[model samples]
Target: MGWLSTIIVGFIVGVLAKLLHPGNDKLGFIMTTLLGIAGAALAGFVGEALGWYAVGEAAGWIASTVFAIIILAVYTRVIRKR
Candidate 1:
């Protein structure tokens, strides 16, 4: 469930994140989805660890999307630096 949810949530979040945060992100489909997956997982674990969410509950959509945007920004920065 976790892995499948990650992929599904990743796709949804990826589209939303990209639309909300249009910048110098030269990401393709896979990379964008990867970004979303990373963001979703990050938010889920962090929110859980921070007590923002319960253990079994997935991160909220808004949280996932926002984190995805943050991840995208960080990604672009790293790419730019490299």
Candidate 2:
């Protein structure tokens, strides 16, 4: 159930994150999902560090999306090195 929830929430986060970011990301659906999942993890860490939320607490769509965008940006930069 945890993984399932992550994917579902991640998808929603990915969409919102993409919307939040300016300019097109040119990412496919699968990449978007990956980004969302990664974003959730990133957000979770940051949120925990900043005391925004509990370690296992769920991140709302907006927060998740913003985090996803940041993750996607970093991922893109790393991938471009290849």
Candidate 3:
């Protein structure tokens, strides 16, 4: 159940990130989901480091989406160079 929820949330976050980001990156469903998961993970670490929020907070969703966009940016850059 936890894993299922994570995937669903990741998909939502990834879609949001893709829609919100300025530039475009060619990504499949799995890749997009992965981007979201990675971004959320990154945001979790950053939030903890900066003391912006607590673990498992709903506020983390916004940060997660933002971080997903950032990751999307970097992913596009790297892919473009390849």
Candidate 4:
């Protein structure tokens, strides 16, 4: 996918992940987009390592969302402890 498409899909994935995860995560639009992109990248990396996906392939929605949620949890914890 192109950069623009990746950004668009990342935005949607971020929004979906925020909605699916309970609790208030007061994040702005830019932060959410960044989170989604990072999450997707993380998922893609792990999936590739596990032989679930090949290099240069985008991670699926479910995997992206799951990774995003995991990132969110980690972010919340770190922020809380700071």
Best candidate, TM-score: 3
lDDT of each: 0.83, 0.78, 0.89, 0.85
What number of clashing residue pairs does each candidate have, in the order they appear?
0, 0, 0, 0
User: For model 3, which pairs clash?
Assistant: none
* Candidate 3: clashing residue pairs, number: 0
- Give all TM-scores, in the order shown: 0.81, 0.74, 0.88, 0.86
lDDT leader = 3
Tens digit of per-residue lDDT, candidate 1, span 2-81: 78877887988988999999676878888888988887878887887788877555446777889999999888888899
lDDT, model 1 = 0.83
- lDDT (tens digit, per residue) of candidate 3 on 1-82: 9888888888889999999998768889999999888878888889989999998898789999999999899888888999
Where's the lowest-lDDT run of ten residues in candidate 3?
Answer: 19-28
Candidate 2 lDDT over residue span 1-82, tens digit each? 9889988878878887777777666888888888898888777777878888775555545566788888877776777788
What TM-score does candidate 4 get on C-alpha atoms?
Answer: 0.86
Task: Give the TM-score comparing model 2 with the true structure, all chains together.
Answer: 0.74
